[model samples]
Target chain A: MSDDNQHQETFEDFKNSFNYGSRSDLNFKFLKNLSGEDASHFFQELLWKIGDSFNDGDFTRVVDHVNETQAKAYAGVGRFTYDDSPFTPLRAPLSQLRLGLMTSSGHFVAGDDPKPFGVENMSQQEAETRIDDFLKVEPQLSVIPMDTSIEKLRVRHGGYDVRASMADPNVNFPISRLAELQAEGRIGELASDAYSFVGAASQLRLLNHTGPEWVRMFQEKKIDALLLVPV
Target chain B: MEAGGIPTVVIGVHAFRDRLAAMRLPRTVITPHPMGRTLGAPKDDETQKQVILAALDLLETAQKPGKIIDLPGRYRL
Candidate 1:
Protein backbone atom coordinates (compact mmCIF):
# COMPACT_ATOMS: atom_id res chain seq x y z
CA MET A 1 0.00 0.00 0.00
CA SER A 2 1.07 3.60 -0.60
CA ASP A 3 2.13 5.84 2.34
CA ASP A 4 -1.06 7.93 2.12
CA ASN A 5 -3.25 4.84 2.28
CA GLN A 6 -1.35 3.51 5.31
CA HIS A 7 -1.68 6.86 7.06
CA GLN A 8 -5.45 7.02 6.39
CA GLU A 9 -5.92 3.47 7.63
CA THR A 10 -4.01 4.21 10.86
CA PHE A 11 -6.07 7.33 11.47
CA GLU A 12 -9.31 5.41 11.01
CA ASP A 13 -8.11 2.71 13.39
CA PHE A 14 -7.37 5.36 16.04
CA LYS A 15 -10.83 6.93 15.79
CA ASN A 16 -12.47 3.53 16.06
CA SER A 17 -10.49 2.81 19.23
CA PHE A 18 -11.41 6.11 20.91
CA ASN A 19 -14.07 5.92 23.64
CA TYR A 20 -16.49 8.55 22.32
CA GLY A 21 -19.31 7.26 24.51
CA SER A 22 -17.39 8.14 27.69
CA ARG A 23 -18.60 11.74 27.65
CA SER A 24 -22.31 10.89 27.69
CA ASP A 25 -21.65 8.18 30.23
CA LEU A 26 -19.73 10.56 32.48
CA ASN A 27 -20.98 10.57 36.08
CA PHE A 28 -19.62 11.79 39.41
CA LYS A 29 -19.22 8.33 40.86
CA PHE A 30 -16.07 9.43 42.71
CA LEU A 31 -18.26 11.03 45.35
CA LYS A 32 -20.60 8.05 45.53
CA ASN A 33 -19.45 6.99 48.97
CA LEU A 34 -20.01 10.46 50.42
CA SER A 35 -23.81 10.68 50.20
CA GLY A 36 -26.82 11.63 52.33
CA GLU A 37 -25.90 11.51 56.03
CA ASP A 38 -22.22 10.86 55.37
CA ALA A 39 -21.92 13.85 53.09
CA SER A 40 -23.57 16.18 55.58
CA HIS A 41 -21.20 15.06 58.32
CA PHE A 42 -18.20 15.47 56.03
CA PHE A 43 -19.15 19.05 55.10
CA GLN A 44 -19.81 19.97 58.71
CA GLU A 45 -16.38 18.73 59.68
CA LEU A 46 -14.80 20.69 56.83
CA LEU A 47 -16.68 23.82 57.82
CA TRP A 48 -15.69 23.49 61.44
CA LYS A 49 -12.02 23.37 60.50
CA ILE A 50 -12.32 26.39 58.21
CA GLY A 51 -14.05 28.45 60.89
CA ASP A 52 -10.93 28.02 63.05
CA SER A 53 -12.68 25.32 65.07
CA PHE A 54 -15.28 27.83 66.21
CA ASN A 55 -17.28 26.48 69.11
CA ASP A 56 -18.90 29.64 70.52
CA GLY A 57 -17.24 32.78 69.13
CA ASP A 58 -19.17 35.63 67.52
CA PHE A 59 -18.33 36.39 63.87
CA THR A 60 -16.96 39.84 64.69
CA ARG A 61 -14.98 38.45 67.60
CA VAL A 62 -13.47 35.71 65.43
CA VAL A 63 -12.39 38.21 62.80
CA ASP A 64 -10.77 40.46 65.37
CA HIS A 65 -8.95 37.57 67.05
CA VAL A 66 -7.10 36.09 64.06
CA ASN A 67 -3.98 37.62 62.50
CA GLU A 68 -3.81 38.45 58.79
CA THR A 69 -2.08 35.20 57.84
CA GLN A 70 -4.44 33.09 59.94
CA ALA A 71 -7.46 34.89 58.52
CA LYS A 72 -6.35 34.26 54.94
CA ALA A 73 -5.61 30.61 55.61
CA TYR A 74 -9.02 29.97 57.11
CA ALA A 75 -10.75 31.93 54.37
CA GLY A 76 -9.17 29.76 51.66
CA VAL A 77 -10.19 26.58 53.45
CA GLY A 78 -13.80 27.76 53.63
CA ARG A 79 -13.95 28.99 50.04
CA PHE A 80 -12.18 26.42 47.83
CA THR A 81 -12.36 23.07 49.57
CA TYR A 82 -15.73 21.94 48.28
CA ASP A 83 -16.82 19.07 46.04
CA ASP A 84 -20.20 20.36 44.86
CA SER A 85 -19.05 21.44 41.41
CA PRO A 86 -19.86 19.35 38.29
CA PHE A 87 -17.15 17.78 36.11
CA THR A 88 -16.95 17.02 32.35
CA PRO A 89 -15.21 13.91 31.13
CA LEU A 90 -12.54 13.52 28.43
CA ARG A 91 -14.27 11.64 25.63
CA ALA A 92 -12.07 12.24 22.57
CA PRO A 93 -9.15 10.01 21.73
CA LEU A 94 -5.83 11.46 22.90
CA SER A 95 -4.50 11.46 19.34
CA GLN A 96 -7.44 13.52 18.05
CA LEU A 97 -7.74 16.01 20.94
CA ARG A 98 -6.84 19.67 20.71
CA LEU A 99 -4.91 20.69 23.82
CA GLY A 100 -4.33 24.00 25.62
CA LEU A 101 -1.97 25.06 28.43
CA MET A 102 -2.60 27.16 31.56
CA THR A 103 -0.06 28.13 34.18
CA SER A 104 -0.61 29.52 37.64
CA SER A 105 2.92 30.83 37.37
CA GLY A 106 2.72 34.22 35.61
CA HIS A 107 4.74 33.46 32.45
CA PHE A 108 4.20 35.25 29.11
CA VAL A 109 6.15 36.27 26.07
CA ALA A 110 6.91 40.00 25.87
CA GLY A 111 6.13 42.05 22.76
CA ASP A 112 4.25 45.09 21.54
CA ASP A 113 0.86 43.44 21.30
CA PRO A 114 -2.31 45.30 22.26
CA LYS A 115 -3.47 42.20 24.12
CA PRO A 116 -3.04 43.14 27.81
CA PHE A 117 -2.24 39.64 28.98
CA GLY A 118 1.28 40.12 30.43
CA VAL A 119 3.83 42.88 30.82
CA GLU A 120 5.75 42.28 27.63
CA ASN A 121 8.91 44.25 26.56
CA MET A 122 9.12 46.63 29.49
CA SER A 123 12.10 46.64 31.84
CA GLN A 124 11.63 44.67 35.09
CA GLN A 125 11.35 47.95 37.00
CA GLU A 126 8.67 49.25 34.65
CA ALA A 127 6.78 45.95 34.77
CA GLU A 128 6.81 45.91 38.57
CA THR A 129 5.32 49.39 38.54
CA ARG A 130 2.46 48.25 36.30
CA ILE A 131 1.98 44.64 37.45
CA ASP A 132 -0.86 45.45 39.85
CA ASP A 133 -2.86 47.39 37.26
CA PHE A 134 -2.03 44.86 34.57
CA LEU A 135 -3.47 42.07 36.68
CA LYS A 136 -6.61 44.10 37.30
CA VAL A 137 -7.84 45.03 33.79
CA GLU A 138 -6.30 42.12 31.93
CA PRO A 139 -8.94 39.53 31.10
CA GLN A 140 -8.98 36.55 33.38
CA LEU A 141 -7.93 34.40 30.41
CA SER A 142 -4.95 35.15 28.09
CA VAL A 143 -4.37 33.36 24.79
CA ILE A 144 -0.82 32.28 23.78
CA PRO A 145 -0.41 30.81 20.33
CA MET A 146 2.13 28.10 19.64
CA ASP A 147 5.42 29.16 17.89
CA THR A 148 5.80 32.10 20.29
CA SER A 149 9.58 32.40 20.73
CA ILE A 150 11.16 31.45 24.07
CA GLU A 151 13.36 34.58 23.93
CA LYS A 152 10.27 36.74 24.41
CA LEU A 153 9.04 34.90 27.51
CA ARG A 154 9.43 35.96 31.15
CA VAL A 155 8.20 34.66 34.51
CA ARG A 156 6.56 37.11 36.93
CA HIS A 157 5.46 34.84 39.77
CA GLY A 158 6.39 36.18 43.22
CA GLY A 159 5.64 33.07 45.23
CA TYR A 160 8.43 30.76 44.10
CA ASP A 161 12.03 30.54 42.88
CA VAL A 162 11.59 31.69 39.27
CA ARG A 163 15.22 31.32 38.25
CA ALA A 164 14.56 28.06 36.42
CA SER A 165 11.73 29.50 34.35
CA MET A 166 13.72 32.68 33.77
CA ALA A 167 16.45 30.57 32.22
CA ASP A 168 13.97 28.42 30.28
CA PRO A 169 10.26 29.22 30.00
CA ASN A 170 9.48 25.61 29.15
CA VAL A 171 10.20 24.78 32.81
CA ASN A 172 6.68 26.05 33.48
CA PHE A 173 4.86 26.54 30.14
CA PRO A 174 6.11 23.69 27.96
CA ILE A 175 4.81 24.94 24.59
CA SER A 176 7.94 23.63 22.86
CA ARG A 177 7.20 20.07 24.03
CA LEU A 178 3.55 20.43 23.03
CA ALA A 179 4.63 21.44 19.54
CA GLU A 180 6.87 18.38 19.33
CA LEU A 181 3.97 16.14 20.34
CA GLN A 182 1.79 17.70 17.68
CA ALA A 183 4.45 17.16 15.05
CA GLU A 184 4.91 13.55 16.09
CA GLY A 185 1.11 12.99 15.93
CA ARG A 186 1.02 12.07 19.60
CA ILE A 187 -1.89 14.55 19.83
CA GLY A 188 -4.18 16.16 17.28
CA GLU A 189 -3.45 19.91 17.40
CA LEU A 190 -2.87 22.78 19.81
CA ALA A 191 -5.24 25.65 20.42
CA SER A 192 -4.12 28.92 18.87
CA ASP A 193 -3.65 30.26 22.39
CA ALA A 194 -2.68 29.03 25.85
CA TYR A 195 -3.42 30.88 29.12
CA SER A 196 -1.74 32.30 32.29
CA PHE A 197 -2.86 33.43 35.77
CA VAL A 198 -1.14 34.42 39.02
CA GLY A 199 -1.81 31.59 41.46
CA ALA A 200 -0.67 33.60 44.46
CA ALA A 201 -3.72 35.84 44.53
CA SER A 202 -5.40 35.53 47.91
CA GLN A 203 -8.70 37.19 47.14
CA LEU A 204 -11.58 34.74 46.82
CA ARG A 205 -13.68 37.24 44.87
CA LEU A 206 -11.04 37.47 42.14
CA LEU A 207 -10.68 33.69 41.82
CA ASN A 208 -14.42 33.01 41.97
CA HIS A 209 -14.94 35.45 39.11
CA THR A 210 -11.99 34.46 36.94
CA GLY A 211 -12.15 30.67 37.19
CA PRO A 212 -15.41 30.28 35.30
CA GLU A 213 -14.56 33.11 32.93
CA TRP A 214 -11.40 31.24 32.00
CA VAL A 215 -13.50 28.13 31.36
CA ARG A 216 -15.81 30.06 29.04
CA MET A 217 -12.84 31.38 27.10
CA PHE A 218 -11.38 27.89 26.82
CA GLN A 219 -14.66 26.63 25.44
CA GLU A 220 -14.78 29.60 23.07
CA LYS A 221 -11.33 28.70 21.77
CA LYS A 222 -12.72 25.23 20.95
CA ILE A 223 -10.25 23.45 23.19
CA ASP A 224 -11.20 19.81 23.69
CA ALA A 225 -8.96 19.43 26.77
CA LEU A 226 -6.53 21.37 28.92
CA LEU A 227 -3.24 20.59 30.66
CA LEU A 228 -2.92 22.82 33.74
CA VAL A 229 0.56 23.22 35.24
CA PRO A 230 0.02 24.70 38.71
CA VAL A 231 2.90 25.97 40.81
CA MET B 1 -13.54 24.16 36.19
CA GLU B 2 -14.15 20.47 35.59
CA ALA B 3 -17.70 20.68 36.86
CA GLY B 4 -18.35 23.50 34.42
CA GLY B 5 -17.64 21.16 31.43
CA ILE B 6 -13.87 21.42 30.88
CA PRO B 7 -11.74 18.35 31.23
CA THR B 8 -8.62 19.71 33.04
CA VAL B 9 -5.69 17.65 34.21
CA VAL B 10 -3.43 19.33 36.77
CA ILE B 11 0.31 18.80 37.17
CA GLY B 12 1.04 20.23 40.61
CA VAL B 13 3.39 19.99 43.57
CA HIS B 14 2.69 17.48 46.32
CA ALA B 15 2.50 20.27 48.89
CA PHE B 16 -0.89 21.26 47.50
CA ARG B 17 -2.37 17.76 47.19
CA ASP B 18 -4.71 18.13 50.19
CA ARG B 19 -5.88 21.54 49.03
CA LEU B 20 -6.36 20.31 45.45
CA ALA B 21 -8.38 17.38 46.76
CA ALA B 22 -10.60 19.76 48.70
CA MET B 23 -11.08 21.98 45.64
CA ARG B 24 -12.42 18.85 43.92
CA LEU B 25 -10.28 19.24 40.79
CA PRO B 26 -10.70 16.65 38.04
CA ARG B 27 -7.61 14.61 37.15
CA THR B 28 -4.45 15.59 39.10
CA VAL B 29 -0.88 14.27 38.93
CA ILE B 30 1.41 15.36 41.77
CA THR B 31 5.21 15.36 41.85
CA PRO B 32 7.30 15.82 44.99
CA HIS B 33 8.80 18.96 43.54
CA PRO B 34 8.77 22.57 44.67
CA MET B 35 6.20 25.11 43.54
CA GLY B 36 7.47 26.64 40.27
CA ARG B 37 8.91 23.62 38.50
CA THR B 38 5.78 21.59 37.82
CA LEU B 39 7.09 19.90 34.64
CA GLY B 40 10.57 19.06 35.95
CA ALA B 41 13.96 20.71 36.30
CA PRO B 42 14.47 23.58 33.83
CA LYS B 43 15.49 22.57 30.26
CA ASP B 44 15.42 18.90 31.11
CA ASP B 45 13.54 18.02 27.93
CA GLU B 46 13.35 14.27 28.37
CA THR B 47 12.01 14.49 31.89
CA GLN B 48 9.64 17.30 31.05
CA LYS B 49 8.28 15.43 28.05
CA GLN B 50 7.72 12.33 30.13
CA VAL B 51 5.92 14.33 32.79
CA ILE B 52 3.63 16.04 30.26
CA LEU B 53 2.78 12.76 28.59
CA ALA B 54 1.96 11.19 31.95
CA ALA B 55 -0.41 14.03 32.84
CA LEU B 56 -2.20 13.63 29.47
CA ASP B 57 -2.48 9.93 30.14
CA LEU B 58 -4.14 10.77 33.47
CA LEU B 59 -6.69 12.90 31.59
CA GLU B 60 -7.74 9.78 29.66
CA THR B 61 -7.53 7.14 32.39
CA ALA B 62 -8.86 8.98 35.42
CA GLN B 63 -12.42 7.69 36.02
CA LYS B 64 -13.83 10.21 38.48
CA PRO B 65 -13.51 13.65 39.99
CA GLY B 66 -10.69 14.69 42.40
CA LYS B 67 -8.48 11.81 41.28
CA ILE B 68 -4.89 12.50 42.46
CA ILE B 69 -2.11 10.26 41.16
CA ASP B 70 1.50 10.53 42.39
CA LEU B 71 4.04 10.64 39.58
CA PRO B 72 7.25 8.74 40.32
CA GLY B 73 10.41 10.69 41.23
CA ARG B 74 11.37 13.69 43.32
CA TYR B 75 12.76 16.94 41.91
CA ARG B 76 15.62 18.25 44.02
CA LEU B 77 16.72 21.84 44.01
Candidate 2:
Protein backbone atom coordinates (compact mmCIF):
# COMPACT_ATOMS: atom_id res chain seq x y z
CA MET A 1 0.00 0.00 0.00
CA SER A 2 1.09 3.60 -0.56
CA ASP A 3 2.21 5.68 2.43
CA ASP A 4 -0.86 7.88 2.05
CA ASN A 5 -3.12 4.84 2.01
CA GLN A 6 -1.42 3.47 5.09
CA HIS A 7 -1.86 6.77 6.91
CA GLN A 8 -5.50 6.88 5.97
CA GLU A 9 -6.00 3.38 7.32
CA THR A 10 -4.22 4.33 10.54
CA PHE A 11 -6.34 7.43 10.90
CA GLU A 12 -9.49 5.44 10.34
CA ASP A 13 -8.42 2.87 12.92
CA PHE A 14 -7.73 5.63 15.45
CA LYS A 15 -11.07 7.27 14.82
CA ASN A 16 -12.86 3.96 15.20
CA SER A 17 -11.13 3.41 18.54
CA PHE A 18 -12.86 6.43 20.04
CA ASN A 19 -16.54 7.19 20.30
CA TYR A 20 -16.68 10.70 18.87
CA GLY A 21 -20.48 10.61 19.06
CA SER A 22 -22.64 11.93 16.23
CA ARG A 23 -20.23 14.75 15.51
CA SER A 24 -19.98 14.64 11.71
CA ASP A 25 -17.93 17.80 11.75
CA LEU A 26 -14.90 15.74 12.79
CA ASN A 27 -14.53 14.25 9.33
CA PHE A 28 -10.85 14.67 8.60
CA LYS A 29 -10.65 13.73 4.92
CA PHE A 30 -8.39 16.70 4.23
CA LEU A 31 -5.82 15.24 6.59
CA LYS A 32 -5.26 12.25 4.32
CA ASN A 33 -4.27 14.55 1.48
CA LEU A 34 -1.45 16.18 3.45
CA SER A 35 2.03 14.85 4.05
CA GLY A 36 2.55 12.81 7.20
CA GLU A 37 4.07 15.68 9.18
CA ASP A 38 1.39 18.16 8.23
CA ALA A 39 -1.33 15.62 8.94
CA SER A 40 0.07 15.02 12.41
CA HIS A 41 0.20 18.74 13.11
CA PHE A 42 -3.35 19.27 11.93
CA PHE A 43 -4.58 16.35 14.00
CA GLN A 44 -2.94 17.75 17.13
CA GLU A 45 -4.46 21.13 16.46
CA LEU A 46 -7.86 19.52 16.07
CA LEU A 47 -7.56 17.75 19.40
CA TRP A 48 -6.61 20.98 21.13
CA LYS A 49 -9.59 22.78 19.61
CA ILE A 50 -11.87 20.07 20.87
CA GLY A 51 -10.19 20.22 24.26
CA ASP A 52 -10.80 23.93 24.41
CA SER A 53 -14.47 23.40 23.71
CA PHE A 54 -14.60 20.83 26.49
CA ASN A 55 -12.89 23.21 28.86
CA ASP A 56 -15.30 25.97 27.95
CA GLY A 57 -18.28 23.67 28.63
CA ASP A 58 -19.32 24.12 25.01
CA PHE A 59 -19.00 20.40 24.35
CA THR A 60 -22.32 19.95 26.04
CA ARG A 61 -23.95 20.76 22.77
CA VAL A 62 -22.85 17.39 21.51
CA VAL A 63 -22.95 15.56 24.83
CA ASP A 64 -26.39 14.19 24.10
CA HIS A 65 -25.12 12.61 20.91
CA VAL A 66 -22.31 10.83 22.71
CA ASN A 67 -22.61 7.58 24.57
CA GLU A 68 -23.57 7.63 28.23
CA THR A 69 -20.08 6.76 29.49
CA GLN A 70 -18.40 9.38 27.32
CA ALA A 71 -20.97 11.99 28.25
CA LYS A 72 -20.43 11.32 31.96
CA ALA A 73 -16.68 11.66 31.58
CA TYR A 74 -17.08 14.94 29.75
CA ALA A 75 -19.39 16.27 32.46
CA GLY A 76 -16.96 15.29 35.16
CA VAL A 77 -14.02 17.01 33.54
CA GLY A 78 -14.75 20.43 35.00
CA ARG A 79 -11.95 22.90 35.50
CA PHE A 80 -10.79 23.38 39.08
CA THR A 81 -11.38 26.75 40.63
CA TYR A 82 -9.71 28.43 43.60
CA ASP A 83 -11.28 30.99 45.90
CA ASP A 84 -8.33 33.37 46.00
CA SER A 85 -5.51 34.54 43.80
CA PRO A 86 -2.17 34.73 45.56
CA PHE A 87 0.58 37.25 44.82
CA THR A 88 4.07 37.89 46.13
CA PRO A 89 6.15 40.76 44.83
CA LEU A 90 9.74 40.05 43.96
CA ARG A 91 11.76 40.52 47.14
CA ALA A 92 14.95 41.68 45.42
CA PRO A 93 16.14 42.95 42.06
CA LEU A 94 16.04 40.45 39.19
CA SER A 95 19.79 40.84 38.97
CA GLN A 96 20.23 39.63 42.53
CA LEU A 97 17.47 37.15 43.37
CA ARG A 98 18.03 33.42 43.02
CA LEU A 99 15.63 31.77 40.56
CA GLY A 100 14.24 28.24 40.17
CA LEU A 101 12.59 26.40 37.29
CA MET A 102 9.77 23.88 37.57
CA THR A 103 7.64 21.98 35.08
CA SER A 104 4.64 19.62 34.92
CA SER A 105 6.28 17.88 32.00
CA GLY A 106 7.26 14.69 33.86
CA HIS A 107 10.97 14.97 33.17
CA PHE A 108 13.88 13.39 35.06
CA VAL A 109 17.59 13.08 34.66
CA ALA A 110 18.61 10.05 32.63
CA GLY A 111 20.29 7.14 34.53
CA ASP A 112 18.51 7.99 37.78
CA ASP A 113 17.90 4.73 39.64
CA PRO A 114 14.44 5.51 40.92
CA LYS A 115 12.48 7.80 38.65
CA PRO A 116 10.46 10.59 40.20
CA PHE A 117 6.69 9.98 40.65
CA GLY A 118 7.13 6.22 40.51
CA VAL A 119 7.29 6.39 36.74
CA GLU A 120 10.55 4.49 36.51
CA ASN A 121 10.52 1.92 33.69
CA MET A 122 7.09 3.01 32.56
CA SER A 123 6.58 3.18 28.80
CA GLN A 124 4.66 6.03 27.18
CA GLN A 125 1.88 3.68 26.08
CA GLU A 126 1.58 2.26 29.60
CA ALA A 127 1.59 5.76 31.03
CA GLU A 128 -1.25 6.83 28.75
CA THR A 129 -3.32 3.79 29.70
CA ARG A 130 -2.78 4.36 33.42
CA ILE A 131 -3.64 8.04 33.53
CA ASP A 132 -6.27 7.69 36.24
CA ASP A 133 -4.12 5.28 38.24
CA PHE A 134 -1.17 7.62 38.00
CA LEU A 135 -3.30 10.46 39.27
CA LYS A 136 -3.89 8.48 42.48
CA VAL A 137 -0.18 8.08 43.12
CA GLU A 138 1.34 10.68 45.42
CA PRO A 139 3.00 13.51 43.54
CA GLN A 140 6.77 13.09 43.39
CA LEU A 141 9.24 15.80 42.42
CA SER A 142 12.46 15.11 40.50
CA VAL A 143 15.39 17.44 40.88
CA ILE A 144 17.47 18.21 37.78
CA PRO A 145 20.63 20.05 38.64
CA MET A 146 21.39 23.17 36.65
CA ASP A 147 24.53 21.61 35.19
CA THR A 148 22.69 18.65 33.65
CA SER A 149 22.58 18.75 29.85
CA ILE A 150 19.26 18.65 28.00
CA GLU A 151 20.27 15.43 26.26
CA LYS A 152 20.50 13.77 29.66
CA LEU A 153 16.80 14.25 30.42
CA ARG A 154 13.86 11.94 29.67
CA VAL A 155 10.12 12.56 29.77
CA ARG A 156 7.27 10.18 30.67
CA HIS A 157 3.85 11.66 31.21
CA GLY A 158 0.38 10.10 31.07
CA GLY A 159 -1.49 13.36 30.66
CA TYR A 160 -0.27 14.30 27.19
CA ASP A 161 2.03 13.24 24.36
CA VAL A 162 5.71 13.35 25.38
CA ARG A 163 7.27 13.09 21.92
CA ALA A 164 7.94 16.80 21.63
CA SER A 165 9.38 16.98 25.13
CA MET A 166 11.54 13.89 24.54
CA ALA A 167 12.94 15.53 21.43
CA ASP A 168 13.58 18.85 23.22
CA PRO A 169 13.16 18.96 26.97
CA ASN A 170 13.19 22.74 26.69
CA VAL A 171 9.80 22.54 25.01
CA ASN A 172 8.36 22.30 28.51
CA PHE A 173 11.34 22.53 30.86
CA PRO A 174 13.48 25.46 29.69
CA ILE A 175 16.39 24.90 32.08
CA SER A 176 19.01 25.63 29.43
CA ARG A 177 17.34 28.88 28.49
CA LEU A 178 17.20 29.89 32.12
CA ALA A 179 20.90 29.18 32.42
CA GLU A 180 21.64 31.29 29.37
CA LEU A 181 19.65 34.13 30.90
CA GLN A 182 21.68 33.77 34.08
CA ALA A 183 24.88 33.90 32.08
CA GLU A 184 23.70 37.14 30.46
CA GLY A 185 22.97 38.56 33.93
CA ARG A 186 19.27 38.79 33.06
CA ILE A 187 18.61 36.94 36.29
CA GLY A 188 20.77 36.90 39.38
CA GLU A 189 21.51 33.19 39.73
CA LEU A 190 19.92 29.92 38.64
CA ALA A 191 19.08 27.61 41.47
CA SER A 192 21.37 24.64 41.93
CA ASP A 193 18.55 22.32 40.80
CA ALA A 194 15.33 22.45 38.79
CA TYR A 195 12.17 20.44 39.57
CA SER A 196 9.57 18.39 37.64
CA PHE A 197 6.42 16.42 38.37
CA VAL A 198 3.75 14.61 36.36
CA GLY A 199 1.10 17.34 36.17
CA ALA A 200 -1.49 14.65 35.42
CA ALA A 201 -1.67 13.75 39.10
CA SER A 202 -4.28 14.78 41.63
CA GLN A 203 -4.63 18.54 41.80
CA LEU A 204 -6.36 18.45 45.19
CA ARG A 205 -3.42 16.75 46.85
CA LEU A 206 -1.06 19.09 45.09
CA LEU A 207 -2.91 22.24 46.10
CA ASN A 208 -3.49 21.22 49.72
CA HIS A 209 -0.35 19.26 50.58
CA THR A 210 2.27 18.36 47.97
CA GLY A 211 2.33 21.88 46.55
CA PRO A 212 2.99 23.42 49.95
CA GLU A 213 5.68 20.85 50.62
CA TRP A 214 7.30 21.69 47.28
CA VAL A 215 7.12 25.38 48.12
CA ARG A 216 8.86 24.66 51.43
CA MET A 217 11.57 22.83 49.52
CA PHE A 218 12.05 25.87 47.29
CA GLN A 219 12.21 28.08 50.37
CA GLU A 220 14.89 25.89 51.91
CA LYS A 221 16.86 26.23 48.69
CA LYS A 222 16.62 30.03 49.07
CA ILE A 223 14.89 30.43 45.71
CA ASP A 224 13.60 33.98 45.37
CA ALA A 225 11.31 33.42 42.38
CA LEU A 226 9.94 30.43 40.44
CA LEU A 227 9.10 30.03 36.77
CA LEU A 228 6.57 27.26 36.16
CA VAL A 229 6.07 25.72 32.71
CA PRO A 230 3.04 23.48 32.60
CA VAL A 231 2.43 20.98 29.80
CA MET B 1 3.95 30.09 45.56
CA GLU B 2 2.74 33.59 46.13
CA ALA B 3 1.05 32.58 49.37
CA GLY B 4 4.31 30.97 50.42
CA GLY B 5 6.02 34.30 49.69
CA ILE B 6 8.04 32.97 46.74
CA PRO B 7 6.65 34.60 43.64
CA THR B 8 5.87 32.36 40.63
CA VAL B 9 5.04 32.93 36.97
CA VAL B 10 3.55 30.21 34.75
CA ILE B 11 4.40 29.86 31.07
CA GLY B 12 1.48 27.92 29.68
CA VAL B 13 -0.36 27.38 26.38
CA HIS B 14 -3.41 29.34 25.33
CA ALA B 15 -5.52 26.18 24.98
CA PHE B 16 -5.70 26.04 28.77
CA ARG B 17 -6.47 29.69 29.26
CA ASP B 18 -9.86 28.93 30.80
CA ARG B 19 -8.45 26.37 33.19
CA LEU B 20 -5.59 28.68 34.10
CA ALA B 21 -7.99 31.49 34.78
CA ALA B 22 -10.03 29.21 37.00
CA MET B 23 -6.94 28.17 38.94
CA ARG B 24 -6.18 31.76 39.91
CA LEU B 25 -2.44 31.33 39.56
CA PRO B 26 -0.28 34.26 40.69
CA ARG B 27 1.13 35.18 37.29
CA THR B 28 1.05 33.60 33.82
CA VAL B 29 2.22 34.09 30.21
CA ILE B 30 0.07 32.32 27.63
CA THR B 31 1.72 31.15 24.42
CA PRO B 32 -0.17 30.13 21.30
CA HIS B 33 1.13 26.61 21.09
CA PRO B 34 0.00 23.05 21.54
CA MET B 35 -0.20 21.25 24.89
CA GLY B 36 2.95 19.13 24.73
CA ARG B 37 5.13 21.79 23.10
CA THR B 38 4.27 24.60 25.49
CA LEU B 39 7.22 26.80 24.61
CA GLY B 40 7.16 26.03 20.89
CA ALA B 41 8.08 23.30 18.47
CA PRO B 42 10.93 21.05 19.49
CA LYS B 43 14.43 22.42 18.79
CA ASP B 44 13.03 25.88 18.08
CA ASP B 45 15.49 27.62 20.38
CA GLU B 46 14.54 31.16 19.39
CA THR B 47 10.84 30.77 20.17
CA GLN B 48 11.57 28.86 23.33
CA LYS B 49 13.90 31.56 24.59
CA GLN B 50 11.38 34.23 23.75
CA VAL B 51 8.71 32.45 25.78
CA ILE B 52 11.08 32.08 28.72
CA LEU B 53 12.06 35.72 28.55
CA ALA B 54 8.41 36.71 28.46
CA ALA B 55 7.74 34.72 31.62
CA LEU B 56 10.80 36.19 33.32
CA ASP B 57 9.68 39.65 32.37
CA LEU B 58 6.27 38.94 33.87
CA LEU B 59 7.93 37.85 37.09
CA GLU B 60 9.64 41.21 37.47
CA THR B 61 6.83 43.44 36.22
CA ALA B 62 3.62 41.84 37.43
CA GLN B 63 2.43 43.87 40.41
CA LYS B 64 -0.68 41.83 41.22
CA PRO B 65 -2.04 38.30 41.05
CA GLY B 66 -4.08 36.59 38.32
CA LYS B 67 -2.28 38.44 35.53
CA ILE B 68 -2.38 36.36 32.34
CA ILE B 69 -0.44 37.93 29.51
CA ASP B 70 -0.96 36.64 25.97
CA LEU B 71 2.38 36.28 24.32
CA PRO B 72 2.20 37.55 20.73
CA GLY B 73 3.62 34.73 18.62
CA ARG B 74 2.91 31.34 17.15
CA TYR B 75 4.83 28.10 16.86
CA ARG B 76 7.46 28.61 14.17
CA LEU B 77 8.33 25.01 13.45
Could you give candidate 1's per-residue lDDT for residues A12-51 as a string of tens digits?
Answer: 2332232121211101111222334543454455466558
- What are the DockQ scores of the candidates, in order? 0.32, 0.48
Candidate 2 lDDT tens digits, A1-231: 568755654554444343222221112222323455654555565566578787886654332222222212222214688767878999777889899999988898888623534556878766766777878866678889988998899888777768888888889998877888899999999999999888888878887889889988898999999999887
Chain A TM-score of each candidate structure, as shown: 0.54, 0.67
| lDDT tens readout by residue for model 2, B1-77 | 77788999998776577778778888989887766788988889889998888888888888888888998754556
- lDDT score, candidate 2, position A140: 78
- Candidate 1: interface RMSD in Å? 8.6
Model 2 misplacement above 4 A: A1-77, A113-120
The list of candidate 1 runs beyond 4 A from truth reads A1-79, A112-140
Task: Give the local distance difference test score of model 2.
Answer: 0.75
Per-structure clash totals for the candidates = 4, 0
Question: iRMS of every model, one decimal?
Answer: 8.6, 6.2
